[model samples]
Target: MRPAPVVLVSGTETVLADRAIRLLRDTLRAEDPTLEVSDLEAGSYAPGELLTLASPSLFAEPRMIRVDGVEKTSDAFLEEALAYLRSPADDTYLVLRHAGGVRGKKLLDAIRGGLGGGVEIVCAELKRDADKLDFVSAEFAAARRRITGGAQRALVAAFSDDLAELAAACQQLLADTDAEITEATVEKYYGGRVETTAFAVADTAIAGRHGEALGLLRHALASGADPVPMVAAFASKVRTMAKVAGARGGGNQIAAQLGLAPWQVDRARRDLQGWTDEGIGRVIEALADTDAQIKGAGRDPVYALERLVGIVASRGEDQHSPQRTG
Candidate 1:
């Protein structure tokens, strides 16, 4: 399809917004190799700049003018943009990049109300694991590459904290290999991220693997992983297990009720086995203390972490048990 005369790329997801802009640029360039591309910073825009770029050249080639930071646009840019929307130029693509603010309300209102007859591309944040998984799948799908379901989930779990990193991981896998992507592939590429390592420690600890959890925790800390997020990982997994502990329903139904992804609900349900409500509550209490200690309430953060691991591994019973004798 031909590019819209005016395009509004709005929202706070920089990765998605940049992808949208690049796709538009690539499409226009393919349609007309002689496409004249120009970039204007709306935040520092000068008067008449948009018109200067949008004006017809002697060669009269197609033009693509991208206006960025529209959410912080100056008054002059705002006025001229509103006017441009009143009459968008022919054979020209005007893309307005807005990262969300109230700075250019009048102009945004005009464009949204059909003053420019433009198409909107909203890049909302990918907050849910399901959404992030969809993003990973689409990235691979766009390249006509294949990725297994387990690989998709593993990638999401590893890079769940950063969309950019997740996207980069996908791109790296796509660029580096030709084989069908699998869970082992994802682990090979991103098994060392702090989020991944932290979650590993959390999983080991929560499953009663006391020695393994301590080993993983120590390795993670030695690898420069912050203690706060390590505790947070435990808190996150245990909290999820707590949320779905007694809930009875299909994964989708329960996930909706708990505001979690279906995969997360399923994983939590699996983690909840052999765990009682009382055990979960005791773990939560230990997590609170460990969180504070890791944040500087105690003398030895490492010891606090070790203690927390032991507590979780014992299903929150280790803390109350008599100390082992030498």
Candidate 2:
């Protein structure tokens, strides 16, 4: 619909509204003055405020009423909004934004149920991995940048999973390289995911420090950290534990595979001296789960990592903890 009176755009971040508004504006004649964009989220307006602006002089342009901060408004305020949406003014556009959540779900549903056709622009968050990929493709298309699947995943892996951060990284990389967007270019310019970030994230997770791990994961992901590399790094350490255990009792194939000097392998055996096979097994399993999560098998990468650390670190004692079987 060129002018949808009721638009229900919901998401964690209000990143899409700007473009949605622009797309709606472009539908109008260029010289209209009444084109309005409202930030009604401050609070839904009283019915009286819904009054359309007086018609401009014949030469003046059209008008638009944009309401923002709709979620911030009270229930009564939202209820009053229905009156305006009931009969939206012609020659004007209205846009409403909700940051998304139950705080105002009813009002949103009502808007959609009612004046949905009048909705002009709707852009919600792209939270899922597939949505993120779609965003990357769209961004590349907009830039006329040729990007392949490898290039897309590379961008996703280099940028934090957050859509805005990912989008910003794409923009920055696109600008800096001024070349076709490809995997190699993304890797070359966007691979600096910060020093020891993966290590810190993994360590805190494995230490059973949920709060610390969460903060670290959020910080890292927000800063455009690559989940795949982080998972790989963490997996590498778990494999190390596995190696140490395997080599603990004359089973040195893993040590040899890792290219450890005899002395180094000996040190590893010493470090793993008291760890039982089950202890190491649990840790490896947890690591596998972490890997799966990073690869999109599980939910909430941050939470998954947190649970992994807890399961691994806590299981060391359970290896000896008495069984509860009756």
Best by lDDT: 1
Name the lDDT value of residue 286 in candidate 1. 91
**Candidate 2 lDDT, tens digit per residue, 56-149?**
3365555665565565667665766666566655555566656555666666776666653544244665667787788889988998877889
lDDT at 27 for candidate 2? Answer: 67
> How do the predictions measure up, each by TM-score?
0.63, 0.54
* Per-residue lDDT of candidate 1, residues 47-139 (tens digit): 999999999999999999988778878899999988898898888999988878788988878878889888888988899999998999999
Lowest summed lDDT over 10 consecutive residues: which window, candidate 1?
Answer: 317-326
Q: What is the lDDT of candidate 1?
A: 0.84
